[model samples]
Target: MSAPTPQPTALTLHQASRVLEVGFDDGAVFRIPFELMRVYSPSAEVQGHGPGQETLQTGKRDVGISQIELVGHYAVQPSFTDGHDTGLFTWGLLYKLGSEQAELWSRYEQRLAEAGVTRDTPMPAKTGGACASH
Candidate 1:
């Protein structure tokens, strides 16, 4: 039989540290940064409609979470200070983000370099079918 996915045992929001601390029943704890969460949001607004259509997030070094609303029993929806609140972070997603932070950060930096921009660079105005206002 397949093993059941780990469920969250605790969740804490550290506003000052700008991280969400999540503990799982499987004895794993993750402190996911707000900036990282915003940059890697799974929303269509950030992820776009398909592969190669991701909207690179920049100038989010200080992004903050204003609120986090629990969704049913499976996820949490965070409202960012930048006005982004569409991404529903499932337990699995959060766990992945926490476990892969180092690699994700390296990839983010590489993408920034490839785009000829730095992390501090302000994001350009978004324009497209799904994101016409940003």
Candidate 2:
């Protein structure tokens, strides 16, 4: 007989820490970083609709989860601070991501380097009004 599929028993988003804690029925608990989740989003915007069309996500090193909503009984949709809310993070995918975080993160970094992108660079501050006189 095959083992039963694991399901999430609890999900918590730590905004300050920028981490998502997921506890599974199989006694596995994973703390996934917000940046990792953002870059690895399962949305077509990142993964595309077919093979070899995956887009490399960058500039999300400081991203955070703004919201998490249940999608039926199979998945949760996380709305990112970067305005990404289309990925459906299924239990299976979440488990895989958690289990392979180190390797996946390494690959992501490599891809960013190849693309001449660096997460260390911060976004420029927005300025309003040019030298307004008081």
Candidate 3:
């Protein structure tokens, strides 16, 4: 098997609009939105560890990123205002999202529609979780 690729050392996060501007060492850049990140979280709490265990995320339409904490040297943990930070987005995962953002976003929207969930609002302030460990 081939060796794993390296993570980007030049990661920029713009917290104003809750977006992550990730730049790779190879001159690649991707801007990820908070909504997208929350909806596609890889955590078991959000994505679940097994099949048929996915928990659909909703009411994050207006959620903004509170912080982007780097976990070690490989992944980033984004903390959302809605109190979600379980998903640790690794370099490879970020690259995948950057490459297929459009397709992934479309798929997510479709799936949400099929599930009858609408991310149209933010959760109450009391509802919070470990979205970032920094």
Candidate 4:
């Protein structure tokens, strides 16, 4: 027998501009901004496993992406300025994070507050990606 395809209850693109509003079957909606997602990629260029290992990204608060290339059907390849062109985003991880965006965002905000880190003044750019916004 053919496997059942997981169907989403609600999924539609916003007609406003260049944004996508994704909704899951669980009545959860996540409106992810394109610029935000681009800046906060979770590749090795941004996150390096532990504290003091992360690379702070700069010039990305309002910076939009030049392009988003899909790396197969499961993940997407994101490129950035300052010549950063690595990092792969899988569909599973995206879905998981998008599902818990609200809670995760709050926790991230709290952590940043504790660290006295502001999104406006991002730390010096390093080797890893910038805190994996996706």
Candidate 5:
């Protein structure tokens, strides 16, 4: 017989730390950062309608999770501080994300490099004096 599906036993969002901690029934636990979750959201806005249309997310280094609402027994919908609340994070997808985080993060970084985008927003150049009229 097949093993029973694993479900999250505990889910905690650390607002100050910007991390989501998930404990599963199968004894697996994950601490996922909010920025990573935002960038890797499973929403169509980020994933697109099909393959080869994935949008690379950037400048989300300080993104935070605003709330998490249970979507029946199968998924949890997370609302981000940036007003993104479309993605329904299924148990399977969450598990996969936790398990393959390292590889996925590496690929994301590579994609950002290729797109010339940084996870951090660029700071404005500082000027010593006030701007002059043109």
Candidate 6:
């Protein structure tokens, strides 16, 4: 039989530290930063509809999770302080983010450098797109 999916045993939000701490039944614990979550949100708004369409998030170093709601039994939807509330962070995605934190940071930094922007640079005004509110 196929192995069952890993499940989270505990989930805690440290608002002050801006981190999401997740503990799995397998004894794996990950402390994922809120900034990272915002930058790498799994929503279409950020990921876009296809490859090469991803919107690089900027000035998100201070982003915070305003609220988080459980989605059924497999994920949690977080509402970010920057008015982004569309990404549904699944257990698998969360685990991956936590485990690959360093690599992800490196990639994000590289992308920023390529775009001639810095982590502190504010994103330019969003042009017409799926959501006018962004």
TM-score of each: 0.92, 0.85, 0.81, 0.60, 0.85, 0.93
**Candidate 1: RMSD over Cα atoms?**
2.5
Q: 1 or 2, which is superior by TM-score?
A: 1
RMSD of each: 2.5, 8.7, 4.4, 6.3, 9.4, 2.4
Model 1 / residue 103 / CA error / Å? 0.8
Q: List the candidate 3 regions with Cα displacement exceeding 4 Å.
A: 121-134
User: Which has the higher TM-score value, candidate number 2 or candidate number 4?
Assistant: 2
Per-residue lDDT of model 6, residues 28-93, tens digit only: 999999999999999999998889989999999999998999999999999999999999999999
The best candidate by TM-score is 6
lDDT of 1 by residue, 45-108 (tens): 8898789999999999989999999999989999999999999999889988988999999999
Q: If the candidates were sorted by their TM-score against the true structure, best first, what order would they fall in?
A: 6, 1, 5, 2, 3, 4
lDDT of each: 0.92, 0.85, 0.78, 0.55, 0.83, 0.93
Q: lDDT for model 5, please.
A: 0.83
Best by lDDT: 6
Backbone clash count for every predicted candidate, in the order shown = 0, 0, 2, 7, 0, 0
lDDT of 2 at 79: 95
* Residue lDDT tens for model 2, 34-107: 88888889987778677877877767888988899999989999999988898999998888888899999989
Pairwise lDDT winner, candidates 2 and 3:
2
Q: Model 3, range 1-134, lDDT digits (tens) per residue?
A: 97676569677767777677888877788898877888888887787667877777778767788788889878888888877877899999888888789998888788778977666733334445533443
Superposed model 6: Cα runs more than 4 Å off: 1-3, 130-134
- Model 6 misses residue 107 by how many Å? 0.6
